[model samples]
Target: MDYFIIVITSAAGLYFHWWLYVRIKRWMDRDLALSLAGADADKRALMLQRLGEAQASGIKRGDLPAWLARAAGEYAPPRD
Candidate 1:
């Protein structure tokens, strides 16, 4: 039926998308990119500290408000 076809297609789409993400993530990890961004030692260390604090704050990413959620989209580049 239509629903069954949709489910299968959606699953296939998600699998392929995740596969691509994993491949590219291994190619260039986020933290490594951040470290290589030409920042000085003090700035880099401070940023890393803030990143750790953010992680420790336990604010789930999904819980971000809509405005902030859209801002997060800037982290990833558009797919080629």
Candidate 2:
């Protein structure tokens, strides 16, 4: 039916959109992580240490990204 075709097309569109979004997100995150990790040795060590502390303190795997983001924000320099 025509309606079935429309529904299938819409679903495919949504799936492709989501797939693209995830791909772009992953690439951007990798770029940002490399930039931050390569910026300063002391800061990088501190970030790793703090992340270890967080893991030791029982932060779950699913929550680590948000936790790391918050920790990074704390250490990030203020922008003008």
Candidate 3:
């Protein structure tokens, strides 16, 4: 019975963390998208730099915080 309770609590904690991560990711995506889409060149540049850093960290473009599935027109292939 003790083991069962421990298992249940562990599972609940893991689920909570996963749920929090998803919510934060969604918020980040929304903010990043807005920043990139704005007319302010400075803000756009900043966001682009952030995107570059994320790429350097081995994160895919599709996984970037500002990634938009339906908005592919903005991204360009990286120059080597």
Best-fitting candidate, scored by lDDT: 2
Off by over 4 Å in 2: 39-80
TM-score of 2: 0.48
Whole-model lDDT per candidate? 0.52, 0.70, 0.63
Off by over 4 Å in 3: 39-80
- Residue-wise C-alpha lDDT for candidate 1, range 1-80, written one tens digit per residue: 99999999999999999999888853443363345433555444544444445447764544423323333333443355
- Candidate 2 lDDT by residue in tens digits, 32-73: 444556677666666677667765898765776777677776
Clashes of 3: 0
How badly does each model clash, as a count of residue pairs?
A: 0, 0, 0
- Model 3: weakest 10-residue lDDT segment is 65-74
Question: After superposition, which runs of candidate 1 have C-alpha atoms over 4 Å from their true positions?
Answer: 29-80
Model 2 residue 46 CA deviation (Å) reads 12
The full ranking of all candidates by lDDT, starting with the best, is 2, 3, 1
* CA RMSD of each candidate after superposition: 12.1, 8.4, 9.7
Ranking of all predicted structures according to TM-score, beginning with the best and ending with the worst? 3, 2, 1
